[model samples]
Target: MNSKSEALAAAKKRITDLQSQMTAKILAIAAEVEKLMDVTPEREVRDFLRVTCNLPSSELGTYMGFGRTLKGSEALLQKARVTFPVLKALVAADAETRQEIVERMDIGARIDTKEIAVVRKRLTEAKLTPEALMAQKNVRLVAAAARKRSADTAALFREKLASFALHLRKMNASDLALASLSETVRNDALELREQFTDIFGTSRRSLNKINLNSPAFRVAAANDALKRICEGRFGNSSHYAGVKKWPASDSQIIDVLLLLSGHPVPRRGWVRGRNAITELPPHRYRLKAIELCAGAGGMSIGLERAGFEHVALFEYNADAAATLRQNRPDWNVVEADITKVDFKPYRRMDIDLVAGGVPCQPYSSEGDQLGQEDERDLLLESSRVIAEVKPKMFIIENVEGLLHAKHGDHVAEFLRRVAKAGYQTEINRIRAEDYGVAQERHRILLIGIRRELAGSFRMPPRFPERRSNLGDALLDLMSENGWTGAREWARQRRDCPVFDRQGNLIAHGVLASTVVTRRGTPRTKEAARWGSKGINIGGLPAAAPTDAEASKPGYLPGLTARMRARLQNFPDDWKFHGGKQSVADQIGNAVPARLAQAVGLAAFAAIRGVSFDWEAMLWPGDRGRLQMTTPALYLDQPQLAPGRKKPEQNVRTVESAGDW
Candidate 1:
């Protein structure tokens, strides 16, 4: 027994001595890395760490912080190791503050690793002094406030819906008899009209596919009234011929519209992510990124949810760019085409990733399928920027037809070029509904990692079990201002299963078709005329050619710009700037933010060499357990999701899922 005890004691001593030795060795290497500041510093140190110690560039700076703490006084650097984010922040703090933060983590708020990661990243970005850190509680106070305030979103939504009803009623009277409207409705409409004239200097008008007086000063106002009156009635003149039904006269239809408008508090669809990171502060990531073709900032928002810090977002569309710039003023938004921008400035930023949703008209089956022949085809330009930026990774999003475009050579050709630029690339066709989007949007996601880090990349997890229907996605958004017919509207919307042109069920109980750019959205003639600029690029056909709106090859009602953005996974607070059709087009063109989070998380995980638990992510146990993961797709039952593209493309060989 004495000999056994002696052996155990020796073993413990040896472990203790080795731990000290390991810490000392790491400290020594870190010191050497620092000392080489005058000589090819970043490259030499990054290479040594990557090749010898197996640390990627993204993590190299973190270890350097650890070494600095060990050399400094009483900072508890080793304890900080339990949470790397805390370690990261603690290292940045002064010695006394660092120790205080470590102790506070153990006692106060009892923050977990995930929260710590978020807090640390935010603190790092803020770069607060130790004194500021103490006063701010390192932003935990802000997180608590967000959680409390999010509850008020429902009340706010109600207020907005009430205001919406007043406007709709006023717009309804513009074309019909004010005396014909109910006394309560006419009074409310009058007040709203005054407010409208006060804001825009004009009275509202009525509009639809057959209307000629469209694109006036109040097209949104007119269409909104018509939409509220006509929506959920399920009578858009597209029913089967075999069914004999009673049709409402114009006056009777107007009465039903007014009655439905005044029904309940939830007047329009209301959506606040039942489980989503509605804002930042409590959940920010440590990595850096840049986005191209950032329409309405959809992917940018998603990447933010996944914990990335956007360095810049490049977009050429004036209105869509305005929305991004207005909402995220702090972000660096570069308004320019990919070819016009010089990427030399970003070459040394150590950006971890770059994302883009290049225009797909050239490759889409709807148009000429011209592929490389189209002048607007931006594949080469996208590749050039990638080469110049030379980030550790990149993700390119486009319509799924690109997977089968130019007999599939378009994607293959781009892959070869990116490979030549020193990247190991892989492509996958992902269905957006699988990731909780109400619309079944199938997109081709091309992920490219620097060849050296290729081994770390993992195939992004698929969410086939996700089943978000339109009713759940937009119910709360619609339930504003106490509209009485809202519940019934929801019931009918669910009954309205979305089918593709092939007469196949794609998604059930959803509120919108996929958000397409303005040209593809189902806008009434007036709204379309107001939004269309009628210009083509590189000799390609005009994106919005002169069209017959009343017979819009295929038309579906109940999809508004606001609802379209919701279906595209935009948060309620995020606003889209521009006219009705322009906004709709922007929403449609965007990659659903919910789906983008998956790609962002995948790219981030590759850098960190971590595997995600998809099941756990989809189903969480604690309130703060999840920050930005894919939202639950199914509220009650599983439903099939359908993908959408431009009109049937007159395809003799292939067909779209939806029919007009």
Candidate 2:
């Protein structure tokens, strides 16, 4: 062999030897971690590896996971002499696929990470068998041939038209019934028809003759359009239908809805012009938003504080709408059913964000979990708004129960519908306490960004260390009514030990259980839970505990509406509008303002491609005015009070709506 060829072979050998060495070292480290886990606490070992050893968390997880996934297969891996990347990919693969890949390695087949990824995609998307993937004519080759044929300009037009025809034949009255059509559908069809008129130069007089709502007329129009296409014309044979420029509208609600019902959507012909990003109007605010189900203004206040100016806020609840207007007179509050609201006007207005805290009762554990069947469930309607408004990003906050297995299909369909609108989505769960709210409420946020900003968006960082307990959060309000025992009660609550679902110690002080919406007497089990936390849940209190109440034989303070609001992280100045029950519902159902702010800031950062000083933005001194006025309750270290000092005759106090 020539000198160059011989040198190249030598270098290849060196690479293979180095790769084998890396694989062996990775396995050895994984084995050592497994051994150390038996003698040392898992958290200590993990922290040491991260801080001292300086191993990246992602790499550490992969290495440690190897002990569990590839335990008995170490001998086989050594025999194959696989690289670390291939082994890591195998570790991430499903059991059946991983076994197949290992079998290939056992047979001396040379494989790489990219090939493994392709295999995984084929098995998932095309459901190809391991043997089929290994065949001479593999899935990739078949896909390549199909793509090549699809690339032909003439063939592509014919294929799309053929698919459109099939959809027309399947279209039924059920798909076009006016009673079944959403406002989004009607508005989309209207917009598209206008575009269609201008596209073929068909006279408005001719198009106006057709009744869009009538199923028979729609079917006839579809058949005529198909016929004109087959003859190489839109209105005439010489007129090419494929060459017209489509409208630049992003609203595709009608086509997406049709596609969901098994009809093929001709996105290219009708909405190709939508690819152009509409230039937004100059505004004073950093971002423009339209908020749905703007409950009692919790999320609205948070998002507004996070740098969004709402063009409009929609809320079906009369009391909630009143509360929003009562707080921010400048906000355009629309009291209407979201299902009937037409959001297409905002499409061209360049709305940067669309946010909603949709009703959670449909998926709450307290309810039937009817999901899509529940009339209150507006998950799909929210997605429709995302399609209509075509915002840069959207946030949908609901209960954690929305992610349960019972709602898997419903959640999947929701994601798929949003994807059709050119957005990527993810389900993220956040704890209220993690964002500085004292309640133990856990909520699920469905965040979606435009497809182009997929990886740019990320959930905000969590602050577990900053989580406050109920006593520290509500001490001021709890002691407002001359209750002599309030300080001792607060001390007991602050020092309470917390446990996990498994009854293991997890924390020192306890956070309140989710503040439920019911204003009526609590059930037996719920009262017992509150009793253990040194509080009364039997009924909502009219006011904070007084000396008379504390003097009773058995006294445990019940939470007032304002105290509940405090736990929810609502500012003391924010007022509620309604009767006691209605006020309770508003406070209980609303998102914690602090939690919403965290998520909103994260979305703002991603949409605008900017970063924030999290401390300055989230924990500003002005935002903590209410908490600042309250006595500081020790969080971690407990110390003895010098003595029970008498309450000051003229103790300074902050004005609060709770006094009502």
Candidate 3:
């Protein structure tokens, strides 16, 4: 224990020494910067202390090392006045002299130089006069008030400067730094313009006119400036290899610098181009696709993955249209309401597929469920376009609740309408989980095939098996130090159940019940099963659970990270973006990428009438040889009778009676 205490003391002393060294270095750098900008040392020190310590302007005088009011310390106050002209003027004038001048100025009474001298002489003779003292006090009070107002104004100006600095850093122009200057300082703007022009070799007017909003322009400027700075500072030598290794585009580097400096540029698009996969190999068949009620590019991304080249996309939201334009520069993202968009333009195009996920609110349980009455039922426009264009196939996806919708008759009527248009349709429920996503989402898919191709069309098979578990997906994401409950909810965890290494509850797994969202309202077992009274589980304290608490069963005691990951079907590499609520929402709304990939591959197979042998595609040279025990091909075989087995364990299973 004695040795441990000695070691701890030594460590603490080392830390204190390092901190002092860092402080000295920072102060030295600040002094050098002030000298370069021609700013006073005292003003520089004040600015440095305020920023480093995050001290407010009101507290500046109090924290100044000197044990005196800002005005009382004449020597220090004068130094400050160099950077604050108003403060200088106030400090230089005597209180009685100032009041007399103010009175004369206010009443428009001009005093001769001889009268001023007479008054000054009388005040000196009578060392203590009530009227004179009162006048002096009032002047001093006015000066203090003015000083306070100046401080407030200076603080606001500093905030603006900080914000601008942050913005410039984000733009990759970190060389520019703001100087603390009095309002009376001349040529500040000229100096800034000259410095910028000299560094970039571009005129101030031209630089100001460049559109930072355009990604192309921003990227170009960022790249050019970075190259210039690197070449000028490091020379054309291999020693500068480290500088060239930075992965961020010049614009991104600048943007980050600006943010750190205190200015944050407003992000414009979903993401930069470098982040997105913009190209893919073309499909075997020339699939001319059409988007119905497309809002931005959400559905478009899926359709493109499914081997469909969109010939036209219809959207009504103006902002969504702009977003589409920003991403897909050449796409025909028509900004017309689906109801008003005429189908005549597409009649002559060789349309192969019509794909869209119609809006769900009208059929949603939360809505009035006025299926046909809801104006959103204008899906008839999509059907009308399909009828006119006479596509070979069409697909419509919607929320699962649509299956049990009261407007079953309306769905039947719509089917009849599509039949009249000469197409056969099949409706099925698809669970996103079965497709390999972590989320247990169910969507209704309506597939319509032209009568001529009805016999050839077969629904894609379900995933052969579950590829991963919840634990497998999220194990990498758990904190290395282990979980810590949220600050507000930390106390609650004391009474909450805990999980063992294998994720089994120390207590029985059985609980009251799970919470669910129904008709947009959260329903919990706490209200129905436990009444308003709460139960204490294990050693934890009990509190009344709200509607939100009921819906979030995972937030309850003993819920493992793996369970949450399983529900979302997230890939091992996929990470949650927001806090717990955001993670939950994304998991709930996103389609599993694995499931999407499987569906995309299956759709491609159905369209081409071929199977995708993953092993064969990966290694074609081992076509005839058995490189590994695993088979090269996978198929959806029917279930067999109990106790039945294939002649070879690796061979495909034979279908039994009623297997279909």
lDDT for position 539 in model 3: 20
Q: Candidate 3: where are CA atoms >4 Å away?
A: 1-286, 295-299, 318-332, 467-603, 614-660
Please tell me which model should have the higher TM-score, number 1 or number 3.
1
Could you tell me how far off, in angstroms, the CA of residue 634 lies in candidate 2 after the best superposition?
Answer: 47
lDDT of each: 0.58, 0.70, 0.46
**Model 1 misplacement above 4 A:** 1-285, 405-407, 479-483, 495-512, 518-557, 613-660
Q: Estimate, for each residue in 61-111, the C-alpha lDDT of model 2 and write its tens digit.
A: 666677777789888887777777787788888876787788888888888
lDDT of 3 at 548: 47
The estimated TM-scores of all candidates read 0.45, 0.56, 0.37
| Candidate number with greatest lDDT | 2
Write down the RMSD of candidate 1 (Cα, Å).
25.5
Ranking by lDDT: 2, 1, 3
- When sorted by TM-score, best at the front, the candidate numbers are 2, 1, 3
TM-score, cand. 3 vs. native: 0.37
| Superior candidate under TM-score, 1 versus 2 | 2
